[model samples]
Structure formats: structure tokens, C-alpha cells
Target chain A: MIRSIRSQAQFYYGGLVVALVSLILVGFNYYERFGRLKTLDERLDEQLTIARPLMFRGPEERPPPRREERGEDLRRPEKRKPPPPDRFDPLPKLRKEIEVARFREGPQGEEVLASLIRDGFYVLGFKPNGEELFRSENAPDAVVPWVNKRDRAKKRDRDSFQRWSGDFREAIQFGQGRGYLLVGTDASRLHEGLNELMLKLSLVCFALTGVVLAIGWILMGKALRPIDQITKVAQSICEGDSNRRIDTDSIRNELGPLGRILNTTFDRLVRSVQQQIRITADASHELRTPVSVILADCDLALRKESSSERKQETIELCRDTALHMKSLIESLTQMARWDSSSDVLKKEKCDLGQIAEQTAKMFTPLAEEKNVEIIIETTPCETFCDPLAIKQTLANLISNAIHYNKPSGKVTIRTKRIGKSNIIEVEDTGFGISSQDLPKIFERFYRIDKAREIEEGHSGLGLSISKAIVEAHGGSIEAYSQKGIGSRFVIQLP
Target chain B: MKILIVEDNQRLRRSMLEYARAEGCVADAASDGEEGLYKALNWDYDLILLDVMMPKIDGWEMLRRIRERKTTPVIMVTARAQIDDRVRGLDEGADDYLVKPFEMRELMARIRANTRRVENNPQPCLEAGDIMVNTVKRLAYFKDQAVELTAREYNLLEMFMYKRNEVLSREFIYDHLFDERDETVSNMLEVYVYKLRSKFGKDSIQTRRGLGYVFMPES
Candidate 1:
């Protein structure tokens, strides 16, 4: 019951019920007592009417002297003391004290009388005969009787009974006396108790609610703390801190899967970034050596005799080294661009025949110088692809062919359309790839083991970039070679 | 023949001087632009060897100040071997540009080429109106009276006399006078040309609107 009524509204309703019931119960009890008192007065009034004529027959047969008037030495003299003339009557002559004594004789009647008295009563009329008619406590009660009484100033013998002289005469004239009968229990004390109970309960409930809300807020914060930490770790990863890892120990519930996913992603990111940094550092390091060689060689040539014969050789060497440096720088810059965004192939509409012709033309002069036979076979093939990337791919393959070719060697470039795809092949009579390097050529910075000793300036990124470009263009590049034989590189673009 | 070598790099400068000496030319060396400018301004030289990238007033500024009072031929040397560098050097008052760590032979040939113009082109232009520039000797004859001209004025007058009727763009004329390094051509060229005109006669070089000045031969 207490739990159900623990809330503020329930407490208030419960208090109201208790207060209202007390008021109604006490009020009903007081009304029952008053009703009984009115019935007793009615009976007493009937007896008084029977005795009144007998006593008033002729004044010869007088009643005995009143016990309060005559002592033991006097003979009884009963003359109907003529009922006195009307004068003083606040209440009719009703015996109120006697009625109250009779009503108290019942079970629980004491409690009833106690309630009525606490509610308070009023006496309407009184006489020296010690009889009176009065309203019950709770004020508005009506059953009051009338009586005759003397009203003489000289009848002040302390023993001469004073009486209500006017009540019976007025009652006789008016037939019945009328007055209010008020019946109710006193509400002030019971209501004060109920008010005190409500106030205390309200104060307690407000404090409890405050404590509950504060505890709930704190619990929510504590529960989400690990998730907040995981969010921070994820944000760090977004900011390029690939080495950052989630605190697996602190993570629980659904976050365990999240932590595992993040760890896997970070592992992949670290590998790729490390690969790029190594390639860039290795390429720059490799380039510095050749540049130093060129500068040194040029300086020496300038210092020596100005023989025009040796001069051409030095200038050609310098130019070759410069071209190598430029390619290396261009490759590094492209890698940087890829790292910054996507490595996907750039696609555009390009004339493959034109590109092939340009490539062949560029290598023609070098081929003529070496007394080699160069041939180009192509159809008027056009495709959607990154023109620069495709051109670069072709240049790398053809230049590598020419660089490694022998005197009187043959170089052939062929392009053709095969079903919705364009295919290009570069074939050269040169030292071919070893079987071990065939698979690893597409890996960044992976050079051939045997070729490393002979080739000084190949950063090994050219084939990897070519492969990337081909894949980006939705194409593929493949190599087939045998040592001491020729090599062919085939590119297929869709 | 006398040549002035004004490179700041000691090794390259020494090597080039040796090459010049081998060509039977007296080569004098100045290690920086400031020293080079002082030497070239005070002495009469057939050629000046100027380095484009020099400290404490570069070769371009040195040549420009030198051209203010002297008409000595200058050749610029630079380490950046770009073609744009060569063009800029030549435009800034350099008669020639040679990129270094250059071939000693190339440097020598360019030097010979520049000095040849200085020694040969200004001679024997006998008439510009009533004036004759004597070829055999460094003398000017105007109306048969000896008319002396400062070196700067003579060079300016010589430019107008050569392209007598054609309008020469300010840029072309400035390049002719100051080479590529002397970038103050817009103002400096105007001042020098004005000085030359006032001495020779106001109407000697007629200004062509939206083009440049033209040397008009009176009909």
C-alpha cells in the first residue's frame, strides 16, 4: 500500500481519503446521538402533559414540597403554584443534562458524548429548579422542553427555587418551541494531522526523485565511456595515424567486433604507407648517385683538353643521366599524387594508333644510331583510357627494349583491336627477364636479382606503375621472356 | 685582344681564363660583380666576361651601370643550363650567354665571337646625316670638324645609324644595348637614348608611337 501510494499524487489522494472519512464518520455519530436525545425529550413531554391537570385540579391537593425547598421539619403543602407569568425564557424548560446522562449509558456512547462535547453545546433556557432545555453540542439541535417558574425579586430566599416563568406560557401559545439542531464533529484537529502527513510525504518524494535522476545520469555516462574512447581511436585513424590501435581490453559488448575491424584496417594501411615511403626514399637515394656522377664527369671533361672528340661523349652521358633523373622525379611525383587521392586509372578517349606512332618515332632515332631494324604494325585503334598513362607505359617498355638491345637488333611494336579491347605488344631482341623476376616485376621496387648488379639507375618502380596504370584503365600487362632471347610485353585495354 | 673575366667561382673562372689565354687574348679576372664592374668601367676592353649569378650586385646590374658610361661588350655565364636562362642573359645587355660547367672550347668561341663585333662593327660608318664615323681610327668627323663622342653616346648613335628607317621596339633596342641581365632597360635605355639624342640632335632618333624610336635619314 505504501509503495503504491509512494508517488506525490497517490500520497495526496490517500491523505484526502483519510481526512474525508474521519469527517463523515464523526459527523454521522454525532447526528445519531442527537436523534436519541430528541426522542427522549418527546417521551418526557408526554408524561409532563399527563401530570399537569391532576396537579392543577383546585390547589387543595398540593404536591409535596420540593426536596430542594423544604427540609425534614416541614409538612408537605402542595398547591399548584400558579404557573408564573411570562418573563425570562432563553430556552424552554427541557432537562438537557438528564438526556445526556441517559444517552451515555449505551456502548460507545461515551465516545460519542466526548466528540459532541469537543464540538461544544449551548443552553437555551434554565431555572433555579435546576432544569434546563439546551441544544446538543454541535449547536443546531432542536428538542427543547418548556416549564413554569416564579419571577419575584423578593423570592430571593436562597432556598426558594428560581424557575423559567415564560417558557411554558410561550410553548402553550406557540404550540412548540423552534430552534436549530447542529450536528457535526470538530474538523480542525483531524484536518491538521492530515495536512502534516501530506507535506512530509511530498518533501521526501521530491528528494528521492532528485537522487534517482542524478544516479541515472551518472550511470549513463559511465556506461558510454568505453564507446567514447573507441570513437576517439577511430578518429585518430581517420587523421592518418595508421599505427593507432583500439584498447581491446576496455572494449566490450558490440565494440569488440569494431576494435578487430579497426586493427585489420590499420594493419593494411601501415603496410601500404610503409611501401610508398620506402619506394620514394630508395628512388631519391638512387637518383643522387647518378646525378653526382654526371656532375663529376662533366667537371673533369671541362678540366681536361678541349678535344672536340671526347666532348660529344661527355655531353651525351650528361644528357642521358639528366633524362634518367627526370623520369625518376616524375615517377616519385606520380606516386605522391596517388597517395594523396585514389590510384584508380584515369580514363579518356585516346587514339592508340597515334600513340603507337609517336612511341615508334621517338625510339626510331635511337634505333638508327644502333644500326637496328625497327618496325611498327598497328590498326587505327582508338580506346577510352588515360592517354598520358598509356603513353608512359608504352614508352617504358619500348625504351627498355632499345636500351638493352644489341647492334643490328630488331624491335617491333604492334597494336590491334580484338573484340571490344585494344591490345599492344612490344617485342625486342634483347637480354630477357629471368624466370625468378617475372612474377615480382609488378611489385613496387622489386628489381631482378641478376639485373641489379648490371643496371645501376633503375628504381624498379616503372613496371609497377605501368601495371597500376593498366589495371586502373581496366587493362592488363604481361611479360614473356627467356634469358639470352628476346622479351615481349603485352598490354590489353578494354 | 683584351678580355675581362668576371665570374665568382674561382675554379671555373681560372679554367676559362686559361682557355682565353690560350686563344692569344690578355685575360684579366675579377672574382665578383662589384670588382668586375669597377674593372670594366675604368678600363677599355674588347670583351667582358660576366657571371649572371654573382653576389654583391649581380652581373646584370653591373652591366647596366657599366653601360651607363661605357659600351664594352659583355658575355654572361650561368649555372642553370635552361634555354630561358640563356635568353634572359642575352636580353640583359649580354652579347652572348654560356652555361657553366661549360665546355672550355664553347666559352672560347663565344668570347671570340663577341670581341669580334666590338672590334669590328663600330668602325668606318662614315655618314649619319653630315657626320662620318672613321673606321681606321676611333674618331668622329661632323661637317669636317672633329666631333668627339663619349663611348655610351657613340654606341647609342651607332644603333640608330644601323637601322636607319625601321622602328626598333624598346625591348629589341634595350636588348641590343644592355643584353638580357640588365633588366632596368625600360628606364635606363630611355635615359641613355635621350642623352645620345640631345648630343647628336633632338630629331636624330624619331619616336614612333606604339612602336619604338626610328633613326630617320633626312630625304
Candidate 2:
């Protein structure tokens, strides 16, 4: 399947967004885990500091009192002898009240250490001779074993805790030339909390990726809707419905310009089709007359049994008709060429005045025969255009002027510059066209004076050809006429 | 018969004129509708051959104007053979129609048919006493014996037979026999008349002193 631009964009953008979200989620998870672990480490360090002093003190400083000094039964422990126990403890519950005379040092600190162990911390103390000195209750089984192993390893560093863990958080602090103090706490709660957080983050990342992809799909479809419509219209036009055009109003965003351009192309296509149809009709109409004449002449000649001279006359008429047909065909071919290749003109710098003068000179003899005067007025205006096409147009205009003029009428061929264009005007004092026929004068096979036109052997294609040639050169030709007054044809070239 | 040809095609017009004259009809031609209309209005012709497409005034317009006052028969000859044009031409008072590239024989037949209708003669044969002329065949019979004659002689005999007892002036005869372009000597008519007399018998033609010759079948 071919992926449209919308799908491709969705893929890239969704991937980028999903990847970025996943990256941020992972980073946040890591930061949270690091902070939690750091806080736990700090609390463990404080716990170890409080327990350090109690573990390192000697135990023989104070001996326990005899059993009679209690003066009571053992069952009444809370009421009897808090003072006796205090006198025997070095790091006592009321250490502030114990004076230096009351407390005595001992050979081994077992009694003082034993009293310290009665506090609720899990602590172990080791002697310098690699012997176990004291251990508190409720310490994990791995703590004593690890402490004993550390004592034998004999790689002790003073004033620092050697941390170890097996399903728990524990740290063993070794004193200088003394045994180790091992302090431990459970760390399974922290591990379990981090695992829960990681599971939640994965779910969120998946949900976010799904949401982003769905939104991207919707947005991309909306944006590409106009483009899809334009493609459909273009496809239809390519299938030969020249009239089909993109609906510019319905198109939005940057595709609006594309729709407008397609519409313009469609318009050109429709116009070219119409032009082809008209040319075909005109060609058929124009060719029919000469063919009729030739047929008539040949038919008449064949039906008659006349002298050789008369027969020759009919043959000559046929020959003339054939020639007329030839010229008409040639004109049609030229028109077809112009229609097919609108860019056939080879533009060069040429003077309009010079072309006008030459055309006027060429028509002088014909004008004289009709008792019409030919006049030329030039201003030496220069312009860039197809010289051959321009010359043919000028010739057509000048000859039409002479042909339509009255006896002793005047024909003026003038060239000048007006504004940004060069203008060539052919003005005649002829039998001008009426308003009704003026607009149709430039159409092929349209003749105002059919008899006169036929008499002069005009195919009635001259003006239409001239118009085509002029338009091809990026110029315009217009005619202004009044009945019985005259007609003026103006050509403007830029 | 006298006819007017209003055709714009110069060669076709000339050919029509030649064929009409050969068919023993007096024909005059004009190059445009305006000139044709003027000539048609002023002259009384037996028929008019008008072309539909013309300058100054077209054949339809000319025919319209001519139909306004004159009921002279018109045959519209043109290159446009479309049914609509033909119907329009006929509706606009054309007695008959001929499309271009038409055989001259067909045109002559139409001319003869139209002229004969104008003269209220349905028969193709013209009779002046014993001299019976078949206009279609261009043959003359004197009492059941066929006489072979030149085209000009036949044309002369046909004219006399059409207007048997009427005195046809030499000037009128020359005018009818020749076209405008033909340069006629003064004795051309006399030569034709003499030839006709030798063949038909001199007593059959009578010339009034200072007048013209008349065909007298009873003489």
C-alpha cells in the first residue's frame, strides 16, 4: 500500500513524540529512585552514629551489686532498685546524674556493654583479639556471621562503616584496633516502592503514545482533505472532461493556490477544445465553395459538345477553381499551425514604421487600379516581434483597406508609439461595416460582401489569420467601423 | 426568351451566359446583386437566374425586392445545396432552384421549363404552320421532314417560330442573338436571316420596307 503524505507525517511525528515522552519518563523514574536511595542512606548514617559510642566502651568499670542489696523479691523488679542498676551502668539512662565517684571502671566492659545492648538497636561489638564481645537481640542472622567474618579478615579502617546487605540494609563500623560494630535495617520496602513506580511509569508511557498517535491521525486527515479533493478533480480532468475544475472555495490552507492553478489549466483546456471545433467547421465551409465551383465547371464542360476553344475555357475555369481550393487549404493549414503551436513566433527587434512602409508600397499598384490612394506616415517606432508574422498582418490589413474602399478613396498606414506599446494603424475611406456585422468581421468564412469577396478570389480567411498571427506575437488587433464612412484597424505590440 | 443571370462567380456567370445563348435564349448577366436587381427591375425578362450569395445585395434580398412588384419567374442558382437554404429560396419566391456544380444541361432544361411555364405553353414543341420546332431537341421539321441546322440557325428559327406573325426588328434580333461582350458586325442579322430564308423558303418571310421581317406562314 502506498502511504499518503498524511500517514507518513503521522508516523514520524508520533514516533518523535512517543520517544520523547518515554525518555522523560525514564529520566523522572531514575531521579525519584536516586533521591529515595540517598535519603535512606542518610538515615542509616545517623542511626550508625548514635550507636557507635555505645559499642566501643569497655565493660569492667562497674560491677553488679550483691543479691541482698536488691532487698526485695525479684518479682518486684520495677519497684525495687532502679538506683542499684544505675550504679552499675556506665552509659546509663540518667547519664547526666551519674557523678564520676559513683561510676567505676571495669577490666572488661561486659556489664556496661550489656546494659547498652538493652536499648532497642540491633548492634554487635567485636574485641581486638577477634573474639565476639556483645550482640543485641533482634539483629538479623546474617549480621553476626558477617561481623565475625569481618573481624577475621582483619582489614579494618577506623571511623567508617563497612556496609553489607543480604535482603536487608546493614552497615558494620570498625573502631581503631577494636572489633566491628554492625548496624542493619530492612531495605525491601524501598525496593518494593521503586518497582511499583516503574510499573506505573510504563503504563503511562504506553497510554501517552496511544493518545498521541490517535490525535496525530485525526489532525493529519483533516489537513489533507483539501489535497485529496484536488487530486480527484485533477484525475477527472485528465480523463478528458476538460470542463472539470477544482472548487477553489472549498479548498483551504496552502492547497488553495494549487486548486486555482488547476482551474486555470482547465479553462485553457476548454478554450482549446472549442477553438478546434470552430476551426474544423470553418475549414469545411471554406473548402466547400471552391470544390463546388470546380465540380460545376467540369460537369458543365463534360455535358456540352462545344468547340475546342470553349472546352479549353471550361478546363481553365476548373484549373482556376483548383488553385483557389489550394490557396484555401494552405490558409487553413497555416491557421492550424498557429493554433497548435502558439509559440512559433521568433521575436526580433524590428521597426514597425519600416514594416508599415513596405506593406503600403506593396499595395500601391492594387490601390491605383481601384483609383484609391495609399498613404504612409511613420514615426520610426521600434519594437521586438516576429517580423514575418507582423509583415503578413500588415499586408492583410492594407489589402483589405484597398479592397473595401470606394473609388478615389484614401488608405492610410501609420505607425507610432503610444505609452509602452508600438501601434500600427490602417485607416481606410472604404465602405465600412455596419454595427451588426462589425463584431463578426474577424471570423473565418465571414464575408460582408460575399459577391465582391468571391470575385476577388478571397477565401474570407485573411482577417482571421491576421488576428491569430497578431495574438501569437503578444499583440492585439481591433477594428472600428461605421457604415458608409470607413474602417480603421489598429494593432498594438509590446 | 430573355433572361437575367445574377451570379457572383465570374467564370460561372460567363459559362451560364454562354449556355443560355446556345439554348436559343437571350441572356444578360451582372456580377453582383445590386447590379442584377437594377437590371432585373428595369427589364421584362421571361426568367431570372439568381445566385444566393452575392455582394452589395444578396440574391435573397434581391428576390424579395423583385417579388414585391414583379412576378417574373426566378431560378435560384447557388453553391449552398443545404435543405434549409433550398426551402428558404423556394419560400422566398423562387420558381426553381439549381445547385452549383450543376450540369449546364440541367440549367438549360430548367430555363426552358420556366420560360415555357411563363408563356403558358406546356408542350416542348413550337409550331408555326408547317414548321414545327422541338425546343428540347433543337430540331426543326418542315411538313414531317427534319432539317439539320447550325445552333445559331436553329436559335433564329426557334425565335421566329415563337413569335410567328410579329415583326421582329433587325435591331431586336441582334440584341437577342448576341451577348453584351460579342462584337457584332451590322450584317450579321442579315446573314442569319438570309440563311433562314434559303432553308424555309423566301415566301415564308416578309420584310416591310423600312420595317423588319415577319414570319408569314399563310403567304
Candidate 3:
């Protein structure tokens, strides 16, 4: 639906760039999030290691308890040793250790712990009695209860917690078989950083898409400029400016060849138009002359006080003019049929020799008027062709020979076969055509001797019509002539 | 007046010659441009009717060759009625142009106009002293009085008036006054001259012994 090529090209390129950029952005965001989660877990493990020593009583401070004493204490659960009167409780000891460690570490470690606490990270310690022994002031309210049960179920000396709350990465770890520690770190900043990077990348991608689309629109116009020019030229030609042509020299690449072909087509179109105009003009001229003669003769016949004899002569002249006009009209109609390419040849197997002989015989009387001899030689050549059209063509040539011949000139009609084709030749000892006029002899309305043609009542279309008929039958007619020697018309049919 | 018609169409040329003769002009016609050009160059004609399309040479070429030597007034008669053809004909020294299928009356009028132009006489009247012959009306007058004459007598008088004071031979009179189709005796021209003299006055025609007759009007 988008009519402008520029917009279409921009949309395609921009869509592809945006799609690829979005895919890459999504991939990078996922990888970054994964790395952030792993790093948070490792940081939680280190914090638990630092807190483990503080939570457990020193191993050397108490003798190893007897196995029977541990078993009997567990069997008499509540009434057994209410912890020897001198036994030290580890809850207060773990709290004091956490405070000492938090205070004794170097300034960098203390700063790291303080910042972690400020950013909503906290640590907790749980005792073997299934109770929370210590909890940091910033610890989440759910940490003690959750860590007490998790620590009692723990079977290892060191473990890590994995939990998420809002924007924090929380973990529970137990170290040295003493107690469980809970650690939570704020991961919202890392997520926020990744989100910000994605936003910036998206914005860059959009800007890049816009820039690329704009450049593409302009470049496409530049590339298609030659097509626009060719279209404009064609439009002008359609509007009747037949002389208009595209400037092919300025075009290069693919459009260059296209422009040249279009120019050639235009040239042919113009030539045909000019030729049609000429034919119409010549036809009207030829048609009008006979009418003029007839009209004049009639007018003269109707003159007052004219003798009957004069009137009779004028009437005879009118009748002759009318007949000439009829013949000229028929010739013109034939030419028109040929021009329209509507005359299909009626093909039949017929002998070229018989046609030539018959046509020559028909012209014998006329030839004898000028004392010209008619000669026919045939080799029984048989061919597939339109017999009527072939006979007409031969008749036209023979008539032309008789008309142009001097007294006692010879006309020879010969037919023979050569290879796969039949050849018919009509040679005349008449006044041969000049070399200059020989080439144009077959053109419509072309006459080497217009006066002779008029005197003989020839319409000058005989040769042209003959050529068209021969060509329609898959044949060619050619004439070879010398200025004064003689002319030969040759027909080849396949 | 003597006129030449050079048309390629045989019937058209023949009809034009007939019309020229009927109008009392000695007209010679050629069937093609080549013959037309040949006659036009070799002879003096008061007017020439040339067709544009012809055999060896065309009217345009013929006119060009004719203009190179002679200043004979030419009227182009052709079937091409395009304005370009008319302009070309006139530009090539034609005195007038008549398109084919034109009214015979129009051609005759053009012939008259062109011949008048050549003679420097606007009226279609020939004059020798006090005798005036109205060519269009086919009438003659002597001292303002209409003179009754036959067509042949009038033609003979007009020919004499056209070349007054010049001796015209018997053969010349016969050639001008009669059509080629007409068969006339050698002394037929003498009868026309005798009739013209009796009607106009004996002094108007002078006998030149064995040469011919001359129209020498008395001062």
C-alpha cells in the first residue's frame, strides 16, 4: 500500500536492523543477569567463612565428650546434664565474636561490611538447639525462623543460602558444624545497571535505524533516478512527442541497456508513423487525379452548343477515366490489405512453371503490341504455395516488363529447382532500371518513370504488392538491374 | 494565347487540353513531367499547366528547370492540396496552384489569370488599335459596336490581335484554331481570315503576299 519506493525501502531495512539489535540486547541481558547471580552467591560464601569462627566454641577449650554421656543425655532428654555448671553457652560467645570481627578487620573490610549492611544485606547465626543464636540488626524478619529449621537439617560443615526477596540475593550457610549463618545482598543495583545498559543500547539501535533508513531512502532515489527519467520520456512520447528520447549516455549499469532498447523502439515507432502519413498522402493524390479527369470530362460534355461528336468524345474520356479510377482504387485496397498484414496466403501445391507460363501467355498480346517476344522455360519445378498469389506476382512482373520494354525486346520467364527451394526468374530485355532507382523499385508508389507509368495506366503499386504476396508465401523477390542492359526479377520459395 | 498542359494522367491531360481549346487557347499537352519539361524549355508558351507528380521529373523539378531559363507564367495543377504543396509550388516560381478534383471553371480562370499576368493585361480582352476582342465573352467590337463572328473567326481574330503587326502563317492559324481531333482542309484558315476581315473591315487584315496574313491596324 505504500506507494513511495523510498518509504518501502526504509521500512524493510529499518525493520531488519531493529529485529537483530533487539535479539542481541535480549541475549546480553540474560548473560549479565546470570553472572550477577553467580557473583552474589560467591560473595555470600566468603561472608559466611568470616563469620564461621565466631559462631562455634573453640575445640581445645572442652574435653571430648564421652560417647555414652552424649547417648544417655539424648535418652534422658530434659533431665540429663543441664549443661555442666561451668559449661560455656555459645550464643553470647557467637555474638561477641561477630562484634569483634566486625570491629577488628582492616578499614577496607570494615567499610565493605558497613556498606553491605547499609545496602540491606544481613547475617544470622542459628544454634544446634534449633534456635536463632544471633541476628544482625539489618537482617530480614523471616531469616531467624527460616535459618533455624534449615540449620538443623544441614548435614555439612559449610553450605550456602539461595533465596530472593524483592531486590536481594539471600543465602543460609553453616560452618565448622557450629551454626548456620544467613546472608543477603542487594542485587537491585546490578539489575538496574543491566536495565540501564539495555535502555541505552535500545536507544542507540533506534537512532542507528533512523540514520540508516534516511540514508537508504536517499540512496535508493539516487539509484532509481534513471528509471524515473525513462518513465518521463515514455510519458512524453505517449502524449505525442514522438521525438523525445531518454539520454542514455548519462545512465550506467542495468538501466543503460534498458534505455537504449526503449530508444530503438521509439525510433521505429516514429518511422512507421511517418511512413503511414506518406502512404495516405500518396493514396489520396493518386485517387483524386482520376476523379478530376472524370469530372472535367463530364463538365466539358455538358457544355452548351457543343457538337454531338465532341460530347461523345468527352463521354468516352469520362468512361476511360472511370475505369482507370476503379483500377487505381483496387490497387490501393490491395496495398491496404498488405499494410495491415491481414492477407493470409492460401497455400496449395502447384507448379511454378505452369503459373509462369500462364501469366506470360496472358501478357503475350500486350507484348506483341510492342513486338516484344515472350519466352518460357520450365524444369517441372513443383512447390507449395498460394497459386493465385504466385500467378498474380508473376503477372505483375511480366506486365511491368512489357510496359517498360522497347519494340522487339525479349521477356523470358524461367522456373527451376535449386536444393530445397524453387526459383522463378523473369528476365527482360526492356529498358532496365538505373542502379539508383533499382533499390527503391519495390517501395509503394515508387516509380522510376512516372510518365511512362501514367501513360500505361500503371498504379506503381504492382511491384510492391507482388513483393508482399511473395513474402507472405514464405518467399523473397529480388531484382538485379543495369542502367541500360536489362533487369532480372528472381523469386525464391521454400 | 498558347498554353501548355503537362499532366501525368492521360485522361486528365486530354480533358485539360480539350478545356483549353474550348476556351479558344492554343494548348499543347504532355502526358508526363519529362515531356512537359522538354516542351516547356524548348518553346515559348503564354502559360503552362504543370502537374506535381510525373514520370522522369516531377512538376517541382520541371518548374525549377523552366525558371532557370524562361519566365513563362506557370499554373500548377495537382492532386496534392496540402498547404505545404501549395506553398512549395508558389515558392518554386509557379504563378498559381489548382488542386485536383477542382472545378474545370476554376482551372480555366487560373489559366486566364496567369496568361493575363504574363501579358500585363488584367482584362480578358485582346486589342489591336480600335478592335477589341473580349475573350471571356467570345465577342468582338469595333468602335464600341459588337461585331458578329463565328467561334473560329473570333479565335482567328484573337490570335491576330495577340500578335498584331506580325505575320502569322496559314499553318499557324490552323494549328491554333483547330483541335488535333478535327480534320480540316489546308484552305480552312483562309475562310476564317476572310470572314474576320469582312466583319471588322478590310484594312484591319493585311495580306503578306506568299508569307501569311498580318493584322496591321491603320493609324
Tell me the alpha-carbon RMSD of every candidate. 21.9, 14.6, 8.9
Query: Highest TM-score: which candidate?
Result: 3
> How do all models score by TM-score?
0.39, 0.55, 0.65
Model 2 stretches astray by more than 4 angstroms? A41-186, A202-213, A239-241, A249-252, A291-322, A333-351, A368-373, A377-387, A404-436, A451-457, A467-494, B1-219
Interface RMSD of each: 12.2, 2.8, 1.7
How displaced is residue A341 in candidate 3, in Å? 7.4
Best by DockQ: 3
Tens-digit lDDT track of model 3 for A1-494 = 78777767667777787788888888888998898778877887776555444454332433345546556554554654444553478777667567645543547445645665675667666765558765666876764344435444553333455766666676765443455556776677888888898899888877987787788878888888998999999999999999999999999769999999999999978877876786777778777877887788877778786789988887777676677667777888787666655246677788888888888899878888879999989778788888888888899998888777778889999999999989999999877998889899998878776645655578889999999988887789999988777899999988
Arranged by DockQ, best first: 3, 2, 1
Q: Could you tell me which 10 consecutive residues in candidate 1 chain A have the lowest summed lDDT?
A: A167-176
**TM-score rank order:** 3, 2, 1
In CAPRI terms, model 1 is classed as: incorrect
True contacts kept of each: 0.00, 0.39, 0.75
